[model samples]
Target: MLRMNINNLIKIFFLLVILSIEIGQSLIPLDRYSTSSILIDKKLFFFGGETVHNLKPSTTLDQILYLDVSKPFNTVNPPFEELPNTIPFGSSYAIAFPSSQKNVIYLFGGITVNVNTDLDDFKSILHSYNLETNQWTIPTTSGIAPGRRREISGVINNNTGKFYAFGGLSDQFTGTPNNTIALNDMNIFDINTLAWSKGSTINAPLPRADYTATLLSNGIIVFIGGRETNAFRDVDINQLALYDTKVDKWSLMTARGVTMENRFLHSAVLTPDERIIIFGGRKVPNDDPVLNQLAVLNTKMTPYEWSIPQVPAIDNMPLTTSAHSATLVGNYMFINFGQITPITNPQIQLPFFYILDIRNFTWIIQFEPEKSTIDTTSVNKSPSNSTSNSPDLPVEKSDNGKQIGIILGTVGLSIGIGIVVGFLGYKYYKKQKYKHAIPTAGSPTI
Candidate 1:
């Protein structure tokens, strides 16, 4: 009987250990900034960013991390898998895009930090990683590559197999603020021929960095929200810069509707119906994360209007974040690791990843395949009908919060029960052993 009780206690202890591991896995382990991410097939790959939180000349990460979007995942616990092979060099603020060919991801132009030293080196070469074989290679290329720069904005044209890179900071802290050069030139990379060529820079926007370059269905790349000249100044937020890939020309237009302040280091996703959803970034002058974290730009509308979609307040809704990666998978946009506060601010908090369902503008904590569908009625209408304030949308409750709560409760209960059982079993065993022990020769019998 005693042996059986001991075995049962051991079993309970092991169960407790396993449960603790499961709980640990639910917490996010990644802390990164300025990372570039791309969605290829069903997997989303993240590469090259600073990992450490408060270090100057921040630590650059070389490991490639990926999450399978096809599988069910949640903000509480993202199933991010790391590839065994690392990139050729550690980098941050690089541009990553998929090649027209299968299983190929291209990385271009990021700065590398030597953790042991103060030297920060700028990378100018193009590197390719093969997903199938898990290999990284620097392919030989022809034509002049863009001058070494980081915080560059780039988008790949699937139709022509070309990548358009524009506007990046050439140097950082080389001397005074004026020494840091912001570039306005456009560089084109051909995936098929492994060559680089200069794109037309006539009427290009002024030198900028940390901006977003989104490719439209019509082959026009839209440039938005970045710092100009140096990191201190912001480009005019009113001017909508458009680059026509077909004509190799650049033009500026204006957006109407709700006015938006200057922002940089934000993430933008082009929805299926041609709407650009802009999320979290630092604003100008003070470099604080924008309080209004979500905005929508309807590209299909004439003269392009920006609207603030009213997001229902939820317990697990993401906090303000910048330098994050937002990947549009299906109708849901998955936002990954980013700092909640500005790097300069001492109170830095990194929020867990979150998802936004674009169909009806719902914030989802978990990925539910059944719920992922296009609500045609919601997509056709303007996101915000009123200009006075953000348009209020209907609040739809999600079961994900309850599900997470139940899971945590169950785990907690199991752990508590295991502890009690183990403790009781231990005490009972001690009492039994004492009762059964042979009395010492000198001891008096009761």
Candidate 2:
């Protein structure tokens, strides 16, 4: 009877071990696209984008979703939580940044498109989201707000507490059609005074939207890769332009490394090492977009050269993604929610989040690579019939993420089971010894 009981316990324990492995495999979340994310107070905040199933009228997300970065990998319950107060307007393609003030972040300029007419009701409104208060407040400003625009990128000067807005589309292409003009004009918002002022644009980069701007340690805002026209056939600008806030001068930087792609809507982040890490974007839609690569600029160097590190296969980054938000936290860049391809398919949205370790160049997916339920509806865009002769890059093998997660989980669980088994065994032996010491029930008094 004792042998049978022990065998059954061992079998049940192994069964539980298998069940845990399965549960750990299902932790990864579905893919997301066309959203904005920011890291504030060690937490990642994601807002405003169309989900896979709810793409009709291009449903903009108002709910603020967040992930706690301090938790261990794959162990947090309630993977994402919604804030009590939502964004005033459900918008997509909006720019979000952390302000110099603690526990405060600013969101500006996103487009709400009409599904029936395919037009953008663009907004240039600025709303301050207080992480501490869990409230969104539209602070009144004195200066003229930039006219309705989308895809405009901005950087807040922490030193001056001023927000700078660069080139963006002033008018939606609906009314003017092909005559839509990209604004090269710069707008400044004084956070302290709550006023707006026009910044010097004497020699700014060509007026363009969908380009990225990053603030350098020397107070220069670097702009790169935006198209002159919305047409995919139109080549994107390749020059790396620099704007000096101190002198109010604009000039192009002469970079010396591998010829970087002239693409727009791509995201860039300033690494702790002072290098600008530019990831996936395309020169034109429908062409094989840049993939699984990092074009890094050594801004610390005199001439600012670009270098692509030879990372190992295990350290391979995720495949091509654009319109995504890459927020830096500690030593890792949390990249979640963005378009993975230039060509849109109603059925092809991947909503998973990834973490790129800046120190080791390894990629980690936060959730399982399962396809989430999304609107399998086609998005209307200016079509590009162009095809690329360049070879296709390798897709991300998500199995690696799954395998690594499983190994770690299995090891950790095994250690826990071993400890439990040893404890139970010792208890069982003690119980048997106590029974034997009873001296056949009646003889125990001796």
Candidate 3:
């Protein structure tokens, strides 16, 4: 009977372990990378991008995906809702920026792959989407649109209702790095006039591609690291270029805090507090993207400064990557899919995403597929090290405290129960030995 009790307890303990795993997995969402995203109201809308199965490329998705992130969400419970109307063609590396009109966003210039040759075709037309009507439309512009390209970045001035487009690549639609020329031209589109006019390129940054351009509160555009040429040595490292719209002037900014090296294809988003947060990009095409640190540029200060925040080595943190998109929605920054590892297969799929609580500097993986080997999210409140000049920022608040507590609690309880069961089993074994050794019916001992 005692042995049977021990077996039963062991089974119960196993059952508990399984339950804990299931509960933890249910909270992780599936991953999708290389998509364009925009936040309207509290909903995040994802447009055409690539999805992968193993290392093989799946079909490029054209359907619009929407997720209501106003509350804590289980990514797979209902999955992301897809709109019935699909974009004319599936695309990737497109620009999706919000317009002055609420619930409206402009989608411009992306590349569609030629399925047969696996080459990319740059798009020249401009498209717009309305969140309320669930509609997509091709808008008319007076002047000619910019040349066909992808991996281009843009920003909109909400106060002025004008849109600005900066540097991007021109040709090489074959997906080959050779024969590509980066542009340094700037274009302006007046939303009210619906006319496109070329801005002065007299003092613009060097011709570059795969760089991040962020519009600050003071109307200055901050252009961070990117490659001026395909050659790794030609890539701009630890450099910053600032463009002032008011004066139509471009000048190099000498940032004094964290010293970051050259990175391209990284994503940057303006925080609510007038700070620009830059995350994951590649040092060079051949090298893996930086995976461990995030650079914060405070635009509110004169002679802008940067602070490098260290990400804790936790299971749930998303892989540091380049070519990803980071969208700011309230206090949360939603990081969408991009290349996670060094491009083993240029067609590789990275389906995971992460969320940074900017207020507290905590990181969490918003979604990871079941087939994924990524770990659960973890938060480190303190910076690994700080420079004497870095600002004393508020500690970011962590929302996963309860979840972390529960996971730790469950594991602890299971361990404790296992130890108690083992002790009882040991005692039972000793009692049985004593009984067996005792003489019964005057039997002689051997």
lDDT of every predicted structure (CA atoms): 0.75, 0.65, 0.66
Residue 37 of model 2: what lDDT?
A: 80
Q: Give one clash count per candidate, in the order shown.
A: 0, 15, 11
Candidate 1, residues 1-446: lDDT per residue as tens digits? 53455456567767766664444334333367778888886678888677553233436766677876766766766766667687656777888988766998888887766544636553545778899998887778999877778888799888888999997987655666637678888999998887899988788888899888899999989888899876679876667899999999888989898888789888899998899999988877776777678899889987889899988888877777888888888888888877775555544334348899998888998786443532333335647655567687665656786566566755665677777666556545543442333232221100
> Candidate 2 residues 382-441, lDDT tens each?
778696888987758697775776667656666767866665555455445433432321
- Listing every candidate in turn, what is its Cα RMSD in Å to the true structure after a full C-alpha superposition? 18.2, 22.2, 19.9
lDDT of 3: 0.66
Better of 2 and 3 by TM-score: 2
Measure candidate 3: CA RMSD: 19.9
Q: Return whichever of 1 and 3 wins on TM-score.
A: 1
Ranking by lDDT: 1, 3, 2
Models 1 onward score TM values of 0.74, 0.69, 0.68
Ranking by TM-score: 1, 2, 3
lDDT of 1: 0.75
Candidate 1: give its CA RMSD in angstroms.
18.2
The candidate maximizing TM-score is 1
